[model samples]
Target: MSISTATVKERSLLGLKELSRDEIASILDRAAHWDRQQEKMSPILNKHFVANMFFENSTRTRFSFEMAEKRLGAQVLNFAAAASSVEKGESIYDTVRTLESMGIDAGVIRLKPIGLLAELAKKVSVPLINAGDGNNEHPTQALLDLYTMKQHFGELKGLRVSIIGDILHSRVARSNLWALQKFGVDVKFCAPANMQAPELAKYAPYVSMEEALQADVVMMLRVQLERHGEGVLKSADTYRVQYGLTEERAAKLNAGTIIMHPAPINRNVEIDDAIVESPQSKIFTQMQNGVPIRMAVIERAMK
Candidate 1:
């Protein structure tokens, strides 16, 4: 069935609270089906406009969102922090107001500092989509990740998923926790003592890397070097030993357990190159699914 045909509740997705479990499942299913049909069908037929405001550097997410919008026949306007009035100390609210005045249908924003997107969502008139908001959340990325896991494991219910490395500074980890919990997946967080997700017990249990590796899906997130000041990690070897997914560690995972990473991998650091390229790795699929899943989100939001 077409995404437009799905009965998504009438709500703005400022957070996951607006979506029911069934709505999330329907979106993912429609995304998968749309991915296959894009070769033959044009999903976005009418003219549309979408604005992408990125206050931080990005590669996969920014490009993937742009591609998704274009694939659905929407005109995309890119706003970079460096080129914007933020150089002159313009407030984020003012910038968002300026963009809203431009009459865009929706905005995809990535910002540093937690809760920035939520704050912006409060002011913007159009639908506000969080691309990545500091260490807070990247809802779409999490959605795509869940979609990838569902594809690999055949279902999300009761699947044990472990998210390892730099959890404190990762928006992906935060979003994944919410998404996994929403779908009834058993979730685990693995990171250094100082870098574990803040207030971990409030959401899900925190575990050591060893325990997390035992799960059916192992996700490794890149360390945000920008957030961690210079010389904080000391040495790559030290980080790798404590938190990296080495080949030996990969060998310990249960058979059919999927290895994943949200990309721009720090090879030999968070993941051994061999495991990243292995047969069980779904990292590439996660990246590939971004386009279709994002298309599904944009379509649903606009309607």
Candidate 2:
């Protein structure tokens, strides 16, 4: 079942930076083909069992990975942290090894702590796909996002993308930044004062929301209130005026500019309700693209 490309076929995709520009392009291209094949079933992982280990809650990522597994004609096992022996304080090593012992071919994991993926990967024989690890990375989400952009404009080179919101706390922001950087994209970071990612000083430090709106894509990130408490974020009205992708901001977008957000968008906060549903918004399309991109990843990971 091994593909000719061992680097992609055998290894797990923990971060977008692990792939070269060519590899990224290849995944995007493969995603396009997979998107076309959506109505059909692929026995790529027929009878193979894949476990979903979600230490943190998620709507799109968890279900999409499960759907991708089912779509590929594989059996899926859901690992519920609350229901399992994890309540007995069983270690992650024991939990993963216990699942691996049950004959899982691959495992998709999402956790709140960074470095868990690498540590767990070492403890089990199964291939590990990082759904999201703390504020560190979400490679598959980034892949689908890149595919969405590619679908719209046909290429990524020279494209300018502004990522606005909880920059320091968004795994989505980090993953997209890394992947987009490889494609020669003009990536900019924007966030409320303390929320900005200081690590991205090399990428224009921080741009005003108005300035960021001029880019090819104005990507919005959720305020991640869970990480940075409600007390830390501004009042809703003030935040809307300053950072929200409002109607005024959307109207000012240069032609060919698209609005994007990684979902569970904070209504009237990081983005306005109108712009989220507007013609210029690709927020929904990004979610739609997630399936095919994940299908490609799961299919490849089982190889």
TM-score of 1: 0.91
Q: What digit string (tens of lDDT, one per residue) describes model 1 on residues 1-303? A: 222212222424545545578878877987987788836337473466788888888967999988888878887899999998997899877887888798777788888877677666655567777788777777788888999988877888999988988887877887788778888989888888778756865787888777888999899999766566677676778888888999988888888799989888999988988988898899899999888888888887776
* TM-score against truth, every candidate: 0.91, 0.94
Model 1's alpha-carbon lDDT is 0.80
**Could you tell me which residue pairs clash in candidate 1?**
none
- Model 2 lDDT on a 0 to 1 scale: 0.83
In model 2, which residue pairs have backbone atoms overlapping below 3 Å? none
